[model samples]
Target: MTSRRPLSFWIKWLLLIALVLGIALGVTRALGKRKATSEAARATAESLQKTPTYTLSSTDVVTVQSIELTQTVALSGSVDALQTAAIKARTAGEIQGLSKREGDPVKAGEVVARIDSTEAQARVRQTARQAESAQAQVAIAKRTFDNNQALVRQGFISSTALDTATANLSSAEATHQAALAALDIARKSLADTTLRSPLTGQISARLVQNGERVAIDTRVFDVVDLTGFELEAAIAPADAVAVKVGQTARLTVEGLSEPVQATVARINPSVQAASRSVLVYLRVPALPGMRQGLFAQGHIVIGGVTALAVPVSAVRNDKPQPYVQVVREGAVVHVPLQPGATGLKGTEPMRAVEGLPAGTQLLRAQAGLIREGTAVRLSAPATVSN
Candidate 1:
């Protein structure tokens, strides 16, 4: 603390210089560390930019080809009867016995049942008696007319009496003829007691049992023609237009392995008043064990037509319209396409795209992440498969 001012000037200057040098050294080290770090970061960035593109493995790219497809129109309905007939008695009589029962098969004119006709027989006998009385009157009048003619010729009878006898004889003859015709008609009607079938079919019902009092024109039985069953169903106007007579179809039944084959038979042009649907009739191809009124599902083929198709996966819906992932220079690009028809039901590749050209190669695997241009590897070597 004593008299230091003059002596401290030189020392102060040297200390100041040392402090400046130390500060400069620290600054220089920091700058060097920062520069090294900056260079390292730049090199890493450049390396990353030069890396290979992200792509799928060769086993991941699945490819399927486009094929010809056809559009299908479908409608549904159930089975029915082709013809139904109710057998009725033509003459009134007691139902004596039945020759055929329900479910029994019979041909046209075959006896189904019989009836007691005791009253019909009695009516025939009464008609015959009337005919015999009229014939006796005609004979008596004819003999008297002949004797009157002989007496007139011998001058013993009047012309007016002969004429009266002749008129009576003619009237009696006409009455006798009318009575005989009535008797014949009554006997013929009595023969109708043997009830017969009007068609070759199975008996569906029996309205009269044996000993039942049946009246004329009474329904005796119900029969259904089962040779070929009719399937009746209603379809929309749009669907009916596609259906024409004789178009082949397939019938699907629950729990049935094989579908029944059939053809379109009739189409009722008049729309239903309530449902506004056209009635359609389909005839199943005859097969044994087929029964009328059996519930069944019907499908009409209409017909098949060929059109371009593609793998459904190839079709991308990401955009407002449909498109596909097209590869370009190891990047992604989207290509737009129009979709068209489909193939047979199961035959249509599930999730398969339709309407592409037949030769078009499409992506069939995971469609996501597939860009327009990306490295692509086929599950099977595409070059070899082609």
Candidate 2:
């Protein structure tokens, strides 16, 4: 037993190596479990933070639709008649009778007034008697000249006597021609006793009363043709150039319930020095009760064409380009559109844009208050009647 009991150094070394291996294996297992747990906890915290929350309020959106809109113009103007005449007298006489009073309708060639013509009547009769006397004298001269020729051929009268008779006959013929012309003049004077209307019109004014003495070329009646009336307006220097003959325009009176159509008729070439404006004439479409100088406001159509349009407030220039805010599912969408001509003053009905459906609701109120994706409430529906 003493001989076998000699201890081996190799066995002791083997036992030391085994103990070190066992401790290493135990440390590795514990560290692996702790690292995995840390990774799982980190992933769980990151997931909670990634969830998104919506806090903005929302409003319903609408779509754009098309409608027919009437183009209108408003301008200052006065009413005028197309055919206005200052009826005047051609001859001087006393007013004997008035056939037409103010506001009476008259026909062409109808007598409008009568003059006291007692002298004219006497002159006509006197001229007629003188003409008859001249005619009888011409007949006497003709017989005398015939007799003188007969006598000269028969040699019964002296040549000097025949010459004298011929001379007297020529003088009598000249006087008869003068008397005929005088009769014609007297006849015309008699006819001038009645003043007649040259054209069919309404009597607008009367200058002389019955039994009043009037002078030649005196104004007796004023006639006006109301059928051809017009509206006269002063157009600004900026808008005057666009108006032309035959252009369509609209006329609205303060008391009228409906608008009236009109056509461009004339433009004053002379510019007004004070206002730098031109006078424009618009022929009113056949309408009722259009009197002289009725106050009217007309929209002279400066231009025309169908283009894109949107609310005037909807247009915004954020970066030199006009853009509109579109709200979608609580998200803000910026939409930019091409703008057309600057329109007339009013609540701008529509502006030009792209990528919008026919009925998409757009934000129009408090224009500047809207931003990309900002929640909006339509104070009133952004609806436009075409």
TM-score of each prediction: 0.59, 0.58
Which segments of model 2 are wrong by more than 4 Å? 1-76, 153-170, 232-242, 253-256, 265-281, 306-377
Model 1 lDDT on a 0 to 1 scale:
0.71
Model 2, 197-256: lDDT tens digits are: 887778988888888888888899998877777888887766776778998886776556
Off by over 4 Å in 1: 1-73, 81-83, 138-170, 253-257, 308-386
Tens-place lDDT per residue, model 1, 61-147, is 333343334344455665656777888887887887686778999898888887787878898999999989989988998898889
Model 2, C-alpha of 228: deviation from truth (Å) = 2.7
